[model samples]
Target: MAEIVALFLALCVQLLALPVYVLSFLGLWDPFCKKVFFPFFMEKTMVNYNQKMLRHKQDLFRNMMDFADPSGKLSVLELGTGTGTNFQFFPPNCRITCTDPNPHFKERLAKSMAKNKHLEYGNFITTPGEDLSQIPDASVDVVVCTLVLCSVKNVEAVLREICRVLKPGGAFYFLEHVAAERSSWSFFWQQVYRPTWALVFDGCSLTRAIWADIEKASFSEIKLKHIHAPFPWTPIQAHIVGYAVK
Candidate 1:
């Protein structure tokens, strides 16, 4: 029965992805994905997943924000700030700058900001995570990335940029779904579905061991833990949430 459900979900994903593939050929995939498809899909489907992960997010944010500035004011930069889902988790009065490769997220991001009025908005920059040249070195007090590394073209380059933009002793917080254990059935299916998953989800790979790249990044101190997220999809249930200091 579990396998049957997985298969059905995969079929649904494929059906939904067909239009995205067609749009890709016309160079409209990015706008459609960021502005319409993903926001709508995630809002509709991710309610349970977001609720289950709320406590973890709260704990991680509390720790990072506390360490970032004792006074509770922080200059924060979020990579791939899709729909500004993390805005509510930020500390009060935090000045947040957001970045996403797709310029189409501006409208949704503004809506999210409107709901979370405690935090100050610091402009959204349209850029990929691999290159943050516009942000000066060692400037931001906190850098946050959640559910982003799996899709980046170069995980190593993104990590380098994260470190570059972080101030000395700044905190870098991340929460990402990763590949499951090698011997697990989920891992086997993850390998099988990776290509289709990436294509459908705008490059989100199902089998990337993202924690390994975070470990290799140039951070002075690192701490992370691997756990199974409560995602209904078995292949992406494996996740890691932690913070590194630069």
Candidate 2:
């Protein structure tokens, strides 16, 4: 009977943990994820991952000079600037306004901006990428987006907003993980894994045809290059880095 009681206790414990698993899987545990888990995970895992891909990031940012103000008056709008991880990549003296849907990340993003000491912080608006009504059209000199396209509900709407905010000849710099070519084994596996993967990663789709979407957007000049980045051996490592000029 003692053994039976122990087994019952173990089962109860497992049952208690089920909700967390379910919430995590459904990407609805945003508070716990953004406040606790992502802070720790991003600092440890993604920071290192991004460090490995700094060259690609640098290549994308190099075009900033082509569109930015020389007198330190450049205005930048960054979509989905969670935790401000990409703050270090921006050119010095840039006036940067950042936005993300999650309010939990605002504090951490503030702290990151405090530490960076390079760019001037403009505002931290808690809004989704699909809507940017707070920002005026053709007002920003550059818009930066990195690793954000995969999770937004409407990719095209977000793309339109990015295009709308930029000044004439303004640059849109992005680094995104894209769907692998349809013919490859990588593409096959990405399709198989995407459902559960999106569940675990807060609705991030591993198979988003982001490159094609960017290509189809209304940009006067668009140049993108496919480059493999170091992410744990997975089809998600297929990345696109470059800029589109509006």
Best by lDDT: 1
RMSD of each: 3.8, 7.8
RMSD of 1: 3.8
| Each prediction's whole-model lDDT (CA) | 0.84, 0.81
TM-scores of the models, in the given order?
0.87, 0.86
Task: Find the candidate with the highest TM-score and give its number.
Answer: 1
lDDT of 1: 0.84
State how far residue 219 of model 2 sits from its true place (Å).
0.5
Q: For residues 1-246, what per-residue lDDT tens digits would candidate 1 score against the true structure?
A: 655765776676667768766778788876677677777765565556678899888888986556556666789999999788888888886899999987766777788899999988887899999989999999999999998898899999999999999989998999999999987888867865765677767789988888889888899898899988877656788999999999
Per-residue lDDT tens digits for candidate 2, residues 167-206, read 9999899899999887776666676566555654667888
Please state the error at residue 242 of candidate 1 in Å. 0.4
Off by over 4 Å in 2: 1-21, 24-31, 70-72
Q: For model 2, where is the 10-residue window of minimal lDDT? A: 1-10
